[model samples]
Target chain A: MSTLENGTRRSPAIHAPGEREITFGEAIREAIAEEMARDQRIFLIGEDVAAAGSVFKVLVGLLDEFGPERVIDSPISEAGIAGIGVGAAITGMRPIVDIMFGDFTTLVMDQLINQAAKTHYMSGGKLTVPMVLRTTLGASRRSAAQHSQSLHALFSHIPGLKVAMPATPYDAKGLMKSAIRDDNPVVIFEDKMLYQEKGPVPEEEYTLPLGQADVKRSGEDITIVATSSMVYVALEAAEKLDSIGISAELIDPRTTNPLDTGALIQSAQKTSRALVLDEGYSQYGVTGEIASVIADGAFYYLDAPVKRIGAMNVPVPFSPAMEDLTIPNADFVVETAKSLCG
Target chain B: MSETNDTNPSITDLDAEHWLQAYEQMVMIRTFEETANDLYTSARMPGITHLYIGEEAIAVGICEALRQDDYITSTHRGHGHCLAKGAALDKMFAELLGKEAGYCRGKGGSMHIADQETGNLGANGIVGGSAGIATGAGMSIKLRGTDQVSVCFFGDGALGQGLLYESMNMAQLWKLPVIYVCENNQYGEYTHNSKAAAGSMVGRATGFGVHAQAIDGQDIRTVHATARLVIDRARKGGGPAFLVCNTYRFRGHHVGDIDRPYRTREEEAEWAKRDPLTLLEDWLLKSKQAEEHVLERIKQEVKTAVDDAVAFAEEASFPSESEVDQHVYA
Candidate 1:
């Protein structure tokens, strides 16, 4: 084994290329570590990012590898941290500001919407805010109300911001590097439940461009578009549908803003039917956004109405059964896909 | 402790040229704001404008202490700060008129004018919005190992914002080089400062362990001297400092806010007696800094500059409809 720049152990070069299975949290940590080692200007600032290594432990081992200066732990100030990220990015620094929970974005509406999103445009392109705001979303572990939410649709509505939601470890590592190197502001929403989910990630460095959608499964009957944690549920639903007679195609929109509408529209046209699944509220959520995109682009080719499945409108409850019913699971997707295929 | 002595001795120690420049900058700001008022009255300018007429000393003095590369964040009433930091008069007028030659290409009006080359980050419409930005700029300076200092210019209304305390705590904790200048103009829009704020402005900064001071904002010399000391300390790695300027606004909050419902005529008249311009003029003549004719010539030069800017703005065209969607992203 060889040591990485920050003293992390890595496997030596081999004649044949191979993939290593790692958790999504490990992939995110690797991306941040690699980027910081490459550029001294890149730093992490957030609540409990240092000693606690973040609430989800996604940032574990980063504080030790890089000193305190690079791994900064901020006070409980979301607005201040967001504004500071914008300010530092404009001046000369690539800051990855971590907002502990996605629902807390309400506290930083002015900083993110008014300041970061509009600074580049308001400056007439004179200033660029090259920053990444990382936050966690989704509900499953019984964390109710303020702790659980999937609010990517709110961020996608705002211009001048790029939204990324990586479902797998491969996409998590690749998309994060792209976000850090991006010239404009990007918001990365990580699913809380997917942190421990294992997936194959390459040993070599790689990056996935923003606005690109990945087609996880191919089918001729129907298309299912999902985001974040729902992407994994859609793939699992596809497996169940294949055992039956129905074949379902799965599309994961890794980046919500600057969306790959072309890929989505093509899939919808080929399948002639589409079902959008989201963990956010059904009304005015990512489901509606995807349904509209397909309606506008592939309306002629569509053989059936585009259906959508999203979380219940009510707030996530504390009980396990209620919370499970609130968030869409593989069973829900399977039922919805069977209806669409029929 | 002699009452007969000069309230601030450092005011008399400045060179003749320094006094003249400060006096001219204050005059220029007055002329620019008065012209903007005239344009608004005649319906020649678009959108509402917040005049920095009486609080010119705060912007000029704090900016004078900063170098060309030092960073500054401004509030909605930011024209004075932009001018003091070396923004072009014609471009500022063009921006107010929503013309194509404006600093933000007619996209950002008077409230959002910014000159990055001069280190003047764009003015914000939200109160206390720039506090965190200034703190982050200080963090950037520390990370880059630069001796540059950042100044955040906000009003007393912003004192209640959580961002101010949050940013101050971080800046103090990291020992970042920043100066927080609160231009207390006695009003937050229509409400008086006393009715809206509690405790003391100095107490807020001191609570964060930052060095805080309050000075006479009407006296440009005093403002200049105090700003010089605080800005010097910050640049020398002394962390953040807060300076509160006791000032007032002569006009209403915005151009259309004519009726003085929040304040009385007599109260306005009393503050008008300590007009920053008249106070600076009295000091200049009493200190023998310049003759009457010299001051008059400087006034003429400023008037001509303002007139030229207005004419240029009148002649400049509005941005084309095709470019409306441009500059939304980098």
Candidate 2:
């Protein structure tokens, strides 16, 4: 398997090691491992992130690699994490704080939205926070409602924060590197299901700039805007739609907060008809944001009304069958695209 | 040798500077608190202000003993702590008036003034928010291998918060460099300290293995002297310390509330007799180090400084509502 040049530890393939590809989970761990080794200023603070290697093993073997001083295990204190991140960031140190799940981010919203977000502007941009918070989203497993959520929309609505949700292992390393080097507070949400989904990644140090959207698949029938884990599902659906004579394009807005609206609008204008897919619940979801953009920017270029496919308006169920019904999958995307084309 | 042999009597050079600077800082704090009261009552200021009027001794006595780079976490009653840490009065007043020149660029009002340059962390409106921050700052200091101390200023009411216990537990476990200064200022807004506080604050501090003390906060000299001993102890690999300063706030919790009704005018009169300014004035004059004219000139200079600060705040611009979109991140 290829290891990024920044001292990224090579991980055993979560899937079969064919083609030496790394999963999204393995890519994140590599990025963290590499960043810590490169900069003495970087450290990790989170609950069970040390001994248990996190609820998802995204931080597995990190404690052994860096020890407790650098790979800290904190009490179950989300507020403490945010508060400590502020102090550590202010004291000329860069900390890559970990919140076990995206929902717990609400508990420390005051520190994230109020303190970390405004601290730079409050200082009139004199002081900047280089702290990185890494969290996991989506519950393809039976982890239940609270544990499985995509709350990037809330963060995107808040100003002065950078958000990176890289879909590919290559993008994960590149975007995480950029997030670490960023002057502003950044939140990176990695999907739990994508942890085992492997892809080809080059063994090189690189960075994906913020506010750029990656055009995963090019087509003319419709532009499908997706994010995080939803990008893969959207691609699968795009391929299915292509067999049915519908040419669908897929664009992944890797960073949610500083959205790649320029890319989204450009592609939406090309295909007049568009479909926004998000893993979050339909209410005020990322789909809503994408729809608003298509309505505002590409309004005149509409052959059909913009459509949005998202999770049901209820919590994700622990039952695997109910979860399949609750969250949008390739079937939902394929159906939505076919209906739009019809 | 017998007369001079006092174990803690040799207040280190920095300690002595701390004492003199405490007095200087106390004067600045007292002037700022009094000026805020004047400006608030006269309607020159727009919002309600929590004047740290009588609690000046607590902030001055504790913060002066800290290194210039050491951190301090403050409460809503934080103007005294901010000024004591050398926050420019112009910026401070500008902040209170919601001007762009304020420490928080008008986003944070009187309750949330912060100057990171002077190591004064922001003043928090939430009662117990600063305690965890103070503990974390202390952890940062210990982790960085510096003798730097972080002092957390909270009221008797905060002693009940989980934040206090959680922070105390961590500070004790890590042997962090922090000082928990509980300004038991007789009242937490409308509640009396005797009614609100369950156990002695010093007892709580000691329960966590933190070196603890109970000091007379009204006496600035006694407060500074004791603070030097404790602050020095922490600076020399000694862990955290907790000092419960038994004090009183002369004004109501905020400008709109009148405290005189809760305690009779006669009761207020009794507390007023122990005014910190009068106490310091007596100490200065009785020692024959200064005359009436000298003290008056100093007070006049403070007045002139206050006047200029007010004028500066008046001229300072207010950040537009659109500017709120800026500075959410770096």
TM-score (all chains, Cα) for each model: 0.96, 0.89
List pairs with backbone clashes in candidate 1. Answer: none
DockQ of 1: 0.77
lDDT of 2 by residue, A1-342 (tens): 223335443331222434467777787888888888998888888888999998878889999999888888887778767777776776677888899889899877866777777767656666667889888788677888899888887887778788888877878888898898888889998887777656666676767898899888889989999887788778778878989899998888889878888899999899989999888777887889889988789999988899988888888888987987888888889998988889
* iRMS, all models: 0.8, 2.3
Worst 10 residues of 2 chain B by lDDT: B1-10
TM-score of 2: 0.89
Residue B85 C-alpha lDDT in model 2: 78
Which DockQ-derived CAPRI band holds candidate 2? acceptable
Per-residue lDDT tens digits of candidate 2, residues B208-301? 7888877777777667777888777877778888878777788888988874566667766787887777777787678665677877776777
- Model-by-model lDDT, in order? 0.88, 0.79
lDDT of 2 at B238: 81
Clashing pairs in 2: A117-B328, A121-B327, A160-B329
Q: Which digits, one per residue and each the tens of the lDDT, describe model 1 over residues A1-342?
A: 122336332222121346677878999999999999999989999999999999988998999999898899999999998888988998989999999999998888889999999998887778889999999889887888888888888999999999999988888999999999998999999998888766678888899999999887788999999888887678778878889988888888899898999999999999999999888899898899999999999999987899999988888899997888888888888887787777
Cα error, residue A337 of model 1, in Å, equals: 1.7
TM-score of the first chain in candidate 2 relative to the native first chain: 0.92
- Model 2 CA lDDT for position A206: 68
